[model samples]
Target chain A: MIRPIHAIQIFLIVAVITLVGNWVGMQQINPVDAALGMLILVAMVMAGWWLARVLPVPFPPIVFVSLLGILLTMPWTPGSEWIVSHTTQVNFLATTTPVLAFAGISIGKDLDKFAELGWRIIVVALVVFTGTFLGSAVIAQAMLRLTGQI
Target chain B: MAENEVVEREFEHNWKLYGIVLILTIIGELIGVRTFQVGPGTALLLPMLYALVIGMFLGPKFVKVVSEKDMSDASPLIVLSVLILVAKLGTTIGPNVPQLIGAGPALLMQEFGNLGTLILAMPVAVLLGFKREAIGATFSNAREGALAIIGDVYGLDSPEGRGVLGVYICGTIFGAIYNGIMSGFIASLNIFHPMAIGMASGVGSASMMSAAGGAAAAAIPEAADTILTFAAASNLVTSATGLYMMIFISIPLANLYLRILTGGRE
Candidate 1:
């Protein structure tokens, strides 16, 4: 069993790995600015964590932070420029590689449970994906026509 | 105090666990990244699919190199990375405000895709004799949003709760793949507006949304940044509305369908 960890430890571990990922792909990053950028991300994460805690609903931390970032960084907003400037140094693509990697590994954890559900689950999954795809396509087709953009 | 020492020791252990995840993530990411650099036909090698495939095959069921516990421990790292990416994606929205405004209701169309699925699939699931439990899985959204609603309405011990869990697991795995395919397929069609298609990529899951939108943007280089931002916003909308849709709309509608199928039988 994994040991229970302090929130600060989790924060440190995330921050360190993220910074390393950023550094690996970032060309000519100033170490000081890079560290500052990492801190900003940490603050954002903490802010999201705080919101998820206080909210009555089961809000996801990542979405909350993303929305908060979007609001503060809108071009007309006061700190938008600072956010835009610093985030550029973070190499967003570099972060995605790790995120997707972890997502894959994480989703696999439930395979046994998923497999136990039987073959019907596969059929259901197929139908669901088909519906979502065709539904999205139909809606997009209509919207595009209404906008006269197509 | 002795308690502080114990906590510190735990922190050290967590660090080690987290480190193992980072190493695996790097390997998965490297493979995924390399696929992007390959020839034109091989553009399918986005990190989303590649990394996931790596994780699934190399996970506990196979090589046993990456355990479920490791995945769980590293979840926070993945979440953090996603936040940063989403935030970065958000920052790009500044320049595309007008295009985003133009996306209009299309940004939300994908979330309703489930409604269409429920309408079509409910009858079939019912015919197949899906229990009230499987109906919850079959009819509802089956994501995090649907779990509490389904469980609350029918109780976790009820078939509805179990059904939702089954579908949720399947959805989590397959949803990502679907998003990747849809993005590329939508982009290739050319009949759909790139912006509109981008808006449709926001199917609630952040990583899936990112994967779909990223593929669209990569395929349509002219509107790359705009597509990313638009999809990100659309994802936000889906999540905000997801809970309500799952409860008031999807659940009631599901029950009605089931009732109609069984001649009003509970």
Candidate 2:
């Protein structure tokens, strides 16, 4: 019963919320704006989940768009050079990467089951992997060829 | 009703182990982000791997162990990690907004390229005979599956859920591959100074826009202020747009392809 149209509707709703939240946050008090922005994000996520239950919408896009909207609208001070420095950016990434890596590892650990799903997962993984590389390369090469940049 | 009661009791009882793993992973991730040089692209892997390990250790029985409390505790870390990433991304954008506009089309095209890979890959998997339930299980458990876990809590572990998981997992692997290929392509174009292909791979996988922007910035820091701008813009857009595009387009495409391939077995 899950339909493709439901996914489209969910995407539209989330996109609207994201745009509205961004516009409103830009006009509001800084802290209040940040908090509201986060709230909007949570609401979008919840909405996606609810929609999935009622319909067949996928969840990643809703989460991604909402996060993107919030990132776009977050308050940033103009004069804080130190905060915006490359070193600081590097530092911030340093603190964040382990968590992501750990998540990857955790997911990889489940590969055994994914493995048990038989060669299907592996075959699919290889096919998806090969297809992506080949597809992107083909497009890139074509674009380069057209531009005479190759 | 009996099945629901059993699942409920099991979830409540095993909640602590889940909490412990979630907390340790968050702490590890926080430390890694703050003190080390791990980027967002790389950082996500940790929790993913941790969950996989936990899944393997706990096996099928522990599926219920990943409870609401675990997700609630883990949510803050996820938010914070992304926030730090955005903060870095914002700094990259603050300096060069105008250039981003000029390069917007190419960047958008790059995104579409990423989407193209997913569209191509999903059907091939389905047509090749990957089970719908397996797809659902994988998607439901991956990062986005945080919500699906909630569905599990409510005893909504149906065929549809499994299908979602399967499709999502397939999409994730494709997403990674797209990053790798695009990163390499960008390097070869010499649109900016080049880094080693391995570094490009890491960057491609690490922070798509940043890696792209960083590479561009490195190549011609002055003439391509626009490159830096595009990099920053693309980073955020890639993350957000990429996710949305996958959900709305890729999932259905996979399902449709599945129907076509399997004669509607799914």
Candidate 3:
């Protein structure tokens, strides 16, 4: 687990990067608006992290973070409209760029281990990814059609 | 050295990583979204892909800009950074709660699709000469949760553990990229509803979900919000319920499948 201070620092850094990405890529959103949105997201994540630490429950911080987001914006909540409207300025895709950037930079330490796994595991991994995706897609298609949702 | 040189160097390495990621985000965002015509289907390439590829270029084995230590330092940051994305995706669910509930059955049933990996990958892994390792690798996507499952049951030193670990590393490396490209391609094929593709994007890993969900949104821009909301809801369900599914269904089924395929052959 990352220390709370370090996690906060990283979240701040990611927020700024995401703000920049939103400003550059999404002309529909103002950078200041997006920054405020980023602030709410960071706060929720930290609050969730704190909750995870304090609560006796063993669920990961993600569960709390997600639940917090849902609760805070559930239309019936007092500030749901404001929260929803502001956060819309931060496009979801823009948020992803920084996340994947970190993922990419972190890949180096695992390269040797990955290479040692040989071509077969690599093939199997790709197959696993493909099967999971296609299988769910097929099932979802059939179910939706049956329910007349599509 | 003041206090501890190692701690000081660790701070420096982390900042360097942060700096590089910041730079990559700017460059990637500037290039922005691109789409290509691959035969009849479209390939949607977003800024995240640019950031990812360029960051890989800075890998220790590549441009050598980052050391192995720097790489390790960046790992936890990846988990931290993804929290913001998770929070963002979660917010997408609140207003759409009714729609999410409406799709509940399909959402619940679609998780079985995760089993698709075991059925398809295990036989191939066996054919390719994997032994007991096939059970771990093909059993699931082997995310952190799945790794814990394997660790608890088989211990990380076992062949099954190694298999799970190997795929976990593979996922850490290329899972997002593969999902990004494939989701866009599949969505472009126009065979399934954007909603189905959205639920399918869950796949139980955050970064991969972001990539797949983003690509699905890009493909069917008309329904982008709904697609993302569905993806987030499905992903949350998978994450919440996936461990139980693995322990009860995936592991045993994978073992049975392997046994049937190998016929007890060494």
Candidate 4:
């Protein structure tokens, strides 16, 4: 687990990257609104991280962060409109860019190990990814069609 | 090999790592979202892809500009950074709670679709002559949760553990790229509704889900909100319950399936 301070620091840095991405890649949102939205998300994430640590159980911080997000933004919740509108300033894709960029940077360490796995695991990996994604999509499509919701 | 050891790297927190990432992100964002038609489906290339692909080139293997320790240091940050995306996706769910409720059954059951890995990958792995490793590789998408599960059950030094770790690295290395392209292509095919593809996007990793969900939505922009809502809801379901399901359901089923497919030869 990341120390809360380190997590917060990283979150702030990532939020800046995401803000630029949102403005350049997605839309030209006001920097103030975007930064405010990122700060709110960072606070929620830190709160969730703190809760996960202090709590007796061993639940992941992400579960708490997600629940907090959902609860705060629900229609009946107080100030949900502000939460929703501010958060809307942060595009989902924009937030993900930094994460994947970090992911790509970290892949070098695994290259040797990955090379040793050879062709078979690569084939299997591709298959597993394809199967899991396509299977769920197929099932959901059928179910939605059956439920008359599609 | 332990999960904690992987995540708890020395907290050097170098500036170069952050600097390179910022530059790559800016370049990627400037390129923005681009699309080209491919046969029936259209390929939607987002800034995320550009960042990832270019960042790969800057890795130690390709460019040697960054050291091995720098890469290790960045590992934990990836998991930490992803929380922002997870929280953002969660916010998408609040307004669409009713739509999520209406599609509840499909949302819940589509997780079983995760078991498709066992059905499809297990046979190929078995025929490829893997033994215990087949069980680890095919049991799940082999995310961090799967890594913990396999480590707990088989010890990370074991063959089964290596199998899961291999898949984990595979996911780490290329999962998002695959999801980005595949989700867009599948969405463009028009056989399945965008909502269904959204539900499918939650394959247990934040980056994969983000790429898959974002790409699918881009392919069908009219239904972007609906698609993203379902993706987030389904992904939350995966994050919360996916572990128990893997422990009680996926692992055992993969073991049994592998046994049958190998005809007890191993």
Cα TM-score per model: 0.58, 0.48, 0.67, 0.69
lDDT per residue as tens, model 3, B192-218: 898889989999887789889998899
Error of 3 at B207 (Å): 14
Off by over 4 Å in 2: A1-115, A140-150, B1-18, B21-48, B59-100, B133-204, B207-237
Among all windows of 10 consecutive residues in model 2 chain B, the one with the lowest summed lDDT is B195-204
- lDDT per residue, candidate 1, B71-119, as tens digits? 5554444434455555555555454454555546656555676576677
Reference contacts recovered by each candidate, as fractions?
0.43, 0.10, 0.70, 0.70
Tens digits of per-residue lDDT, candidate 2, B1-266, equal 11233333322222353344444444443332211223322312332333324433332235554444433323222322233333333344444334334543334445444434445555655555555643333221122422223123221223333233343444343434334345545555654332122212221233433443454444454534644543444444444444455555545555565566668876
Best by TM-score: 4
Interface RMSD of 3: 5.6
Candidates sorted on lDDT, descending = 3, 4, 1, 2
Query: On a 0 to 1 TM-score scale, where does candidate 1 land against the true structure?
Result: 0.58
Looking at model 3 chain A, report the run of 10 residues with the lowest lDDT sum.
Answer: A107-116
Q: Residue A112's C-alpha lDDT in candidate 4?
A: 55
- Proportion of native contacts in model 4? 0.70
Complex DockQ per candidate: 0.38, 0.11, 0.45, 0.45
Residue pairs with colliding backbones in model 3 are none
Report the candidate with higher lDDT, 1 versus 2.
Answer: 1
**TM-score of only chain B in every candidate structure:** 0.56, 0.48, 0.63, 0.64
Q: Write the per-residue lDDT of candidate 4 for residues B117-201, one digit (tens) a residue.
A: 8899988888776788888888999875575456446543446755776776677667787887889899999999888999999
